[model samples]
Target: MPSKSPAQAALEKADKKANSSSGWFSSSSSKYEEAGDLYQQAANLFKMEKLFREAGDAHAREAECREKCQESNEAAQAWWNAAKAYKRGHPDLAIQALSQTITHLTKAGRFRQAADREKEIGQIYLQELNDLRKACESYERAGEWYAQEDAQATANACFKDAADLHADLEEYPQAIARYEQVADGSLSSALTKYSVKEYWLRACLCALAMGDPITAKRNLSKYSSLDTTFSSTREAKFINIITDAIEAGDMETLTAAVYEYDQVMKLDNWKTNILLKIKKGIQEEPTII
Candidate 1:
């Protein structure tokens, strides 16, 4: 028989404490703190043993116990620790732990840290889970915090990530709305002058992809309102071609115009693929002019 490892012994001790406390009926915060300490010890042992999933669970329990005792800082710390543990073995569990961390941080009025955690959560959803919608939601939350802080550059970046994810999901109206929001934020400060025109044009592309000439026209007008000479740019010309193709239900012409635009300035593979998907969607379900 193999000797019991240190981690196994610690787990047993922690389990004993938890089981014994079940009926102790102690309302003292110290009692909960003691149990939380035991759980944390067990979690550390589990991590040393490479039992990361169990470590995460143990740490989460520790966090819960701390939270029940009104230990906000300890609860947040435990949650973050749990997230780190779970990320090694279970991405979904990591995300859940991060969510708890964000909740605790926000409750503690740590808005900047919460926002940073939200962005990390978004990246995990996007890259690890391949869940674009949830990623978009996380990014939107982060953007709200950054906006509240008047960090417009970071806020617009988060919005762009959300918009890109929405576009990836083929939620054109939502993507356009996010892009428009980015453009609006950029126009709020002269610092983002370089990006405002491109953002508006992206919004126009999304509107064209929606096969909504009215929406496309509205975006063009909105751009003019933002910057009087925006229509003179090559991006605006390409957007005009796209809108015209959309209005005429001419996907071939749309493709040709996109090709021409790419010839002059190479388009990203992602944007090109999104355009293809949009064209296919329109061809499958043609809306009236």
Candidate 2:
């Protein structure tokens, strides 16, 4: 028979306290509170032993106990600790823990923290799990929450992250929607209005990638109306040239335009990939007699 370690013994004691059969002597809330403390002790012991998974489990138990006691702030902190513990061993479980933390934070009216946690969740999904779909959802949620909190800068950044992921996934309509959204919001202030051109360019590129020349031309006109300076920018001219080349099925002109633009403003991998797709589409079209 193997002897129980200190953490294991502490967990057993926590379970017993949490499940006590006392009907009248002790209050349930008090029992849960005590159990939560014992669970915290167990978690600390597990962490000291470098048993990260066990520590995470113990912290999760503490969070459950805190929730039962109606201590939302404590529960949120406990869940955050659980997430950190799980992050040391299991990224997926860490994401789940962070989700619980976000829930509790939101319930406690700590939306800024919840929004920040949402971004963390998105990064984990995108970088660690390689799940762009989930990452996009998380970023979109974060953006919405940040926007509600009047943090437009952070909100736009989150939206841009989602838009980039949508573009990468070839979800052109969704990508265009987010890009235009950010561009529209950027119109309100001089500090951010300069960025509207890049956002509109990305949206225009997405429209072109969708083989919707009408929408691309319409968006170009809309952008020019929304920002009087847009018509004078290199981005607007590039979009116009690309739209024309695509309409004429002139691959050489399109390639040359992209090359010229890249010399001044380097296109990133995402834009380069989309341009390649657009080029492939042009090449695959049937030649006129």
Candidate 3:
């Protein structure tokens, strides 16, 4: 018979700790502590052997033991450890552990930590899982927490990320709404004053793409009336040209104006794509009146 490796030995020990953790602790609080400590030891051993799955399980066991021993904070820490252990090696288990961490942290009133987890989950959802919608929700939740903390820049950034993801998924209404929110907020900030027109332009473009003439006209009017700086700018003039063409159902005029803008600004692929979408929307419309 072949001899068991050190990893096997560690796993056996971890299994024993997990199996016997449920013993009746009739007034002896030390039992839970002993089991929790043993589980943590096994978890370290598993990690040392690169058995991340086993390590995650052991760390989770440690958390459960700590919880039963009334060590709430330690339990939360152990759960966090489990999440980290599972993060790289196990996708499903990692999210589950993160959810557990969020629950415990929220119950403990650690809003900041909870927000961090929300942001982390958002990143994982987008990068690892490729679930864009869930990622948007997670980022939006983080934005809300940041807003509560009065971190306006951070909050707006998170909101913008969520909006971008929504737009990438072609959720135009959501993108438009988020863009409008950002534009409205930017108008009130002296530091962000110069960015106001750009934000409104993005919102207007989204409206046009979605074939919402009312919204496009409203945003165009908003741009013209925003401030002296905006009303007199080249971007404001471009909006007027595009809006007039769309309102008149004149595709030729719209095309010419877009070409002019592109020639001057050298539109990036994304901007060109948005403009193409606007043109398509115009072609599909029966009449703007």
Candidate 4:
């Protein structure tokens, strides 16, 4: 028979400790604390054995024990450790661990840490799992939390990621709404006000993609009225040119306008891809006799 490895021995000890009740003289909290310590020991031993998934499970058990003891901070830390251990081999499990971390952090009034973990969950869903919808949901949650914390820049960034994913998924209405929300939020801030034009431009692009030139044109006018200076900006002019070209079914003009704007400010992949979609829409419009 094969000898038990150190990790296996530690795990057995942890299981035995966790299953046993507190002595008659000791409190239940003491039992849970003892079990948590044993679980932590098992986790460390499993890490030494390079059994990451097992280590993650041990950490999760520790977190449960901590929760039973009403130790929110300790539970949050254990959940975070579980997430890190599960991240490389089990992305879905990592996300679950992160969700628990966020929960405990929130319970402990650690909103910023919870928001940060929410963003991490979004990245894992986006990059590791290719689950765009879940990623968007996670980002939106993070953005809301950051906004509540007055971290506007970080909030807007998360909102943009969610909006971009919405656009990629062809959920134009959602994309437009999020962009407009971010743009409106920025209008009152001197530092962020100048960036609102870009957000409005993206919203217009989403409207155009939905084959709603009227809405797109109206949005440009609305932004001008709201910002007062929007009408004179390069973004406003570009949107006008693109809207007119779409109305006239002039694909060349649309392409040239995007190229001109890109010369001033190089468009990123999200903008380039949306513009390509807009151009395709123009090409598909049937010419009236």
Judged by lDDT, which candidate is best?
Answer: 2
Q: If both were scored by TM-score, which would come out higher, candidate 2 or candidate 4?
A: 4
Question: TM-score of each candidate?
Answer: 0.83, 0.89, 0.79, 0.90
Give the alpha carbon lDDT tens digit for every residue of 1-289 in model 3.
Answer: 9998665676566557546645464443566677788788888888888888988998898888788788877888888888888886586787788788888887888877777878888888888899999999999998888778777777777787787787777788898788777777777888977776766777777777787768787767766775657767777788778888888888889889988988887877656788888888777767635
Query: Can you write out model 2's per-residue Cα lDDT over 200-280, one digit (the tens) per residue?
Result: 999999998888888999999998998888999999999999999999988889999999999999999988999998888
Worst 10 residues of 4 by lDDT: 278-287
How many residue pairs collide in each prediction?
Answer: 0, 0, 0, 0
Candidate lDDT (C-alpha), each: 0.84, 0.93, 0.79, 0.91
- lDDT by residue (159-198, candidate 4, tens digit) is 9889999999999999999999899888898999888998
Where model 4 places Cα greater than 4 Å from the true spot, the runs are: 1-5
Give the poorly placed runs of model 2, Cα more than 4 Å off: 1-13, 19-25
Model 1 over residues 1-289: C-alpha lDDT tens digits? Answer: 9999776777677666655644566655766777789889989999888999989998998898798789999999999999999889588999999999988888888888898889989999988899888999999999999888777788889999998888778788888889888887777677887787777777777776676778888779778877887888888888888878777788789889988999997898667876776687678884656
Whole-model lDDT for model 2 versus the true structure?
0.93
Candidate 2: residue pairs that collide: none
In candidate 4 the C-alpha lDDT for residue 23 amounts to 82
| TM-score of model number 1 | 0.83
Worst ten in a row by lDDT for model 1: 19-28
Better of 1 and 3 by TM-score: 1
Better of 2 and 3 by TM-score: 2
Best by TM-score: 4
Model 3 lDDT, residue 184, Cα: 72
- Of models 1 and 2, which has the larger lDDT? 2
